[model samples]
Target: MTGPGMLTALWLTPLIGALLVVVLPSGARRAARPLALATSLLVLGLAVALTVGFDPGGDTHQFVETRPWIPAFGATYSLGVDGIALVLVLLTAGLMPLLLLAGWHDADGSAPSDEGEHDGGEHDGKRDRKKDDDEVGAAGRRAQVYPALMLATQALALVAFTSLDVLLFYVAFEAMLIPLYFLIGGFGGRVSDGVDRAAAAVRFLIYNLLGGLVMLAAVIGLYVLTARAGLGAGGAGTFDYRIITAAIGDGRLEIPPGVALLLFAGFTLAFAIKAPLWPFHTWLPGAAVAATPASAVLMMAVVDKVGTFAMLRYSLPLFPDAASTAAPVLVTLAVISIVYGGVMAIAQTDLLRLIAYASISHFGFIVLGVFARTEQSAAGSALYMVNHGIATAALFLVAAFLVRRRGTREIGRFGGVQQVAPVLAGVFLVAGLATLSLPGLAPFVSEFLVFVGTFGPYPVAAVLATSTFVLAAIYILWTYQRVMGGPVAPGLEGTPDLGLRERVVVLPLVGALLVLGFYPQPALDVIEPAVAHTVELVGGVR
Candidate 1:
């Protein structure tokens, strides 16, 4: 009970676990699975404790931990939880263990092969068996890396969210790209279908790294501005977000509005690429399609949230005047992403890719709400992040299960699934409905809030954005009809329903979605103060 505080432990737990996993011996693969799971669970428990112990009545960083990491550069090891970081942190913790469990496989469980047969007469069987063995090996390798890197990514993201110092936050923010690069390239590259997984990985890295490099420049610029502010004669600029925030507030650090726009553009490019708004989203569908269900879930549910989170945390607060001036343009992009993602999703034959595009559409809502600059919209954006994570995780998990059984994500490859896997189909229905923002579900409340707040300020954009629902419903129901309603596919006549392990992994997410849908007040209550504070910080620019 008297262990490390929430923020400290959250940062260290996964780092320690990741290091242990790397050093683990050859025979320790089995242990690696459980160790990773335990570490993730422990982090989750700490997050829950933090949530329970959180003071909903007040809005400030809680469970604070700060230490001088580099005194000369003005960087520090600083961390604390506000509502936005807190919810995202908890969601990260919740999903890492599930990724591990879904990917778990024993050595003996590998597919058997006939390559060792002694006669030419067995050639056909031999070829078939080798295919099976290769499939097993590929899956095994994926299982090992996906979950481990996911935890590492979570660790980096948590650090980014909690860090009070600008340089530290920037480092953490950029460091996350490394694991995710591997997640998409290394983990996704190995999947058996579609264009080369490596190709998809390369595309993902090239686009994201380009965005990251731009952010690096902005970070240095901000540091220079901060360092020049205080010391009388000659002072080296510092890269501390809190110090910079204070400097900006006092009007001591005056950046040319054009320079501010340039820096904002850098940061915006990075987050937008990650959020995958409109034109920049081409890498996403391929990455998701090539990735395993577990990997897709982590990428869509947790990793993408980093972009939205950075926009809210860094961009708007650091460059409020610029953000306000650019809101109209950004909102336009959000509207296009909404419709474009939905339309493209409807055309995808592949289940994984469809879900990926759908997420693009959903993310448009989050961006719209943030830029709308209303308390209600900001609060809704915050809640939508949590809701999206849960709904997406559920959808991807079910999609993964279906792919394993049918050996394809093609809508044409599946049919009458509900008759065979009633439970799975039911869960899929729930996830799909949540995506459509059906009344009584998590997305409904959040999406409604986004529209309500944005419509007042950007009515046309809001109305155009609402078309996403029609588009979303079209894709979701189309998928359902193609995959679940007709007579069962040839090889899937007796497909197994969700196993106990799969159920154990998925049920919690389902319950979470339902609970949040009904009583989102807890998350909303905690975020209101932070949202208001953020709005006020940006409002001062005018």
Candidate 2:
């Protein structure tokens, strides 16, 4: 039995860390680093403890902590995790400390440069000289702020995933944007050519904010409906997901099928923009190009999962009939996104942009699997989310390393990289193979299941999607040849290999992908029950 105190601590730990990091003085910059790392590590330990405590046989929400938060609005400071969410939560926690380590040096560096191999004494001397120079600039003055904000972003993300109260979840969801906006705007981008990180941040914010505002309206509407049904005596209009899910399940909260569709449209629209499916995907290429590797991984791998997770957890269950009615429309958009994103990937010269477009194509597959509405499809979709996160994170880390060494993101700028940095090229190869769903990699099984399940119900869409996988091979292999196998580009001589720190950070992601690929039963077993619950909830109404 998880206590309310433990649940509250889980949410507050990061938030409190954010504030502490923000206030830490510039003179105490090194001290702040440990604080951020410690906070994330503690959170990770807590999450692991959560898993050990979790009962595999129990499909219901575990570690529930409920208490009145706002009596007037029927909101509570409630938190719980099911098996499906528990896995994701663990993944999220596990990733954060590594990300913190990845960004530790540059989080506060205004004019960031890749750290070079050096003996400890020499490195310390160089760092001292750099710090002395930095002390004279505005960059030094703001060093503490960015790192603190980064930690804050991680904390808020954790809160959003764990919150049982829908309104609290929404708040955490929106709150996370504030720190990320600063991270991209303040700390990321190509510093050499004076790339405008500020512009990219603004673009990221405007696109997301527009969608979030619409979601706000839909959220309010849900509360109003809950109130009309006399939930919580109509005083507070319960915003607890469990309560709302129960009400919808019991036939107490009824809305016209048309109105339900409209509300779901709002919710789905916000998620789609985040998923950045096809036409709504323009923001991603820019943001990914502008962001630091660590930030991009979090944005693409973890943050984007929010949309798909919400679709599974909220949209389908609450409005089953509407979801069914809208399935074909969503599927159409998804298929178009599949072909369009792949075609765009074929056109990209920039490695970062290519990865961004790849995500768009992959997202289409995820959407296809989810909306196909078969049990296997949904289960595959869930597992695909985890698989994609691990693979994409690995790919982005490799790309960032390439950029650091070669001073370019252009595919045309490099060739025969494998000759110089065989280890690095090998990492890229494995990650690319995983991206293409090669057998014995994480995505292969999940993708195969998606095609198997969906082709039965959506043969045409599945056929079109299968073609995208062929295109996936084209873009992935094409880029690989240009960057790794052809003539080594001039002046990229003696490029350093992956450092110990990078290997320590990325190897886990690669290992997880392989482990899950070969044996996904552990994840499948956990997610199937949740997927079945959702399928039954939605399938019953249909």
Model 1's TM-score against the true structure:
0.91
lDDT of 2 by residue, 118-232 (tens): 4557557779788668654556545566557766777777776778888888888787889888778777775464456778889889988888898889899988888888787
Backbone clashes for every candidate come to 3, 1
Instruction: For each candidate, give its TM-score against the true structure.
Output: 0.91, 0.92
TM-score: which candidate is best?
Answer: 2
For 58-171, candidate 1 gives per-residue lDDT tens digits of 647777777878777666787877888888888888888887788665222443222343565656977978966777665555445556787788888888878777678778
Model 1 misplacement above 4 A? 1-5, 106-146, 188-192, 231-234, 540-542
